[model samples]
Target: MKVHIHVSLKSGVLDPQGRAIHHALEGLGFAGVNDVRAGRLIELDVDDSVTDAQLDEMCRKLLANMVIENYRIEKVGEKENA
Candidate 1:
């Protein structure tokens, strides 16, 4: 099975890197760029037998830092479907 995880900073958090990128984009003549928020996408190929609970545990344990970021997990194709 395939797992797609998206981890992003919560609202009201400061994102210096995203701000820098937004500035750079405006410099490149990209107008109307209001804001930018950067996040991470993690893809994992695991056994089909892996449960949702297990995947959630994996995200909390290693994939995402629960302190500053929130994580959402999505299960993609199973081995047979793939």
Candidate 2:
């Protein structure tokens, strides 16, 4: 099975990289982009037997910083839930 983990900063947390990208876009004459919140997508190929609990554990323990980041696990071909 293939999984995609989307990791991003929490709502109240500041994102310097996102800000920089926004600024760069404005500099390059692109407008109407009010905000940009950057995030990451991690793709993994795991056995079909991998349980959702194990995937969540992987995010909580190693993939994401529980302090200021949030993550969503997406298993290919299935609808995702928080």
Candidate 3:
């Protein structure tokens, strides 16, 4: 099975990288960007036996820092994962 993990900062947390990008866009006079937020995407190819509970545990334990970051787990179909 293919698992896609999207990790991002929770609201109210400061994102330095996002701020930098916003600044850079303003510098370039792009002006349309009101705000910016950055996140990470991780695609994993796991065995069919891997369960949802186990995948969520993996995120909570090692993939994301639950204190500041939130993660979403998406199961991709084989056609898409391929």
Index of the highest-lDDT prediction = 3
* Segments of candidate 2 deviating more than 4 angstroms: 77-82
Clashes of 3: 0
Candidate 2 — which pairs collide?
Answer: none
* Per-model CA lDDT versus the true structure: 0.89, 0.92, 0.93
Q: Tell me which of candidates 2 and 3 scores higher on TM-score.
A: 2
lDDT of 2: 0.92
List, residue by residue over 5-62, the lDDT tens digit for candidate 3: 9999999999999999999999998978989999899999999999999999999999
Q: Least lDDT summed over 10 consecutive residues: which range in candidate 3?
A: 73-82
Instruction: Please tell me which model should have the higher lDDT, number 1 or number 3.
Output: 3
Residue by residue across 1-82, what tens digits does model 2's lDDT show? 7899999999989999999999999999998999999998998888989999999999999999999999999887444423
Candidate 1 accuracy as lDDT: 0.89
> How many Å off is the CA of 4 in candidate 3?
0.7
For each candidate, give its TM-score against the true structure: 0.89, 0.91, 0.90
Evaluate residue 38 in candidate 1 and report its C-alpha lDDT on the 0 to 100 scale.
94
- Stretches off by above 4 angstroms in model 3 are none
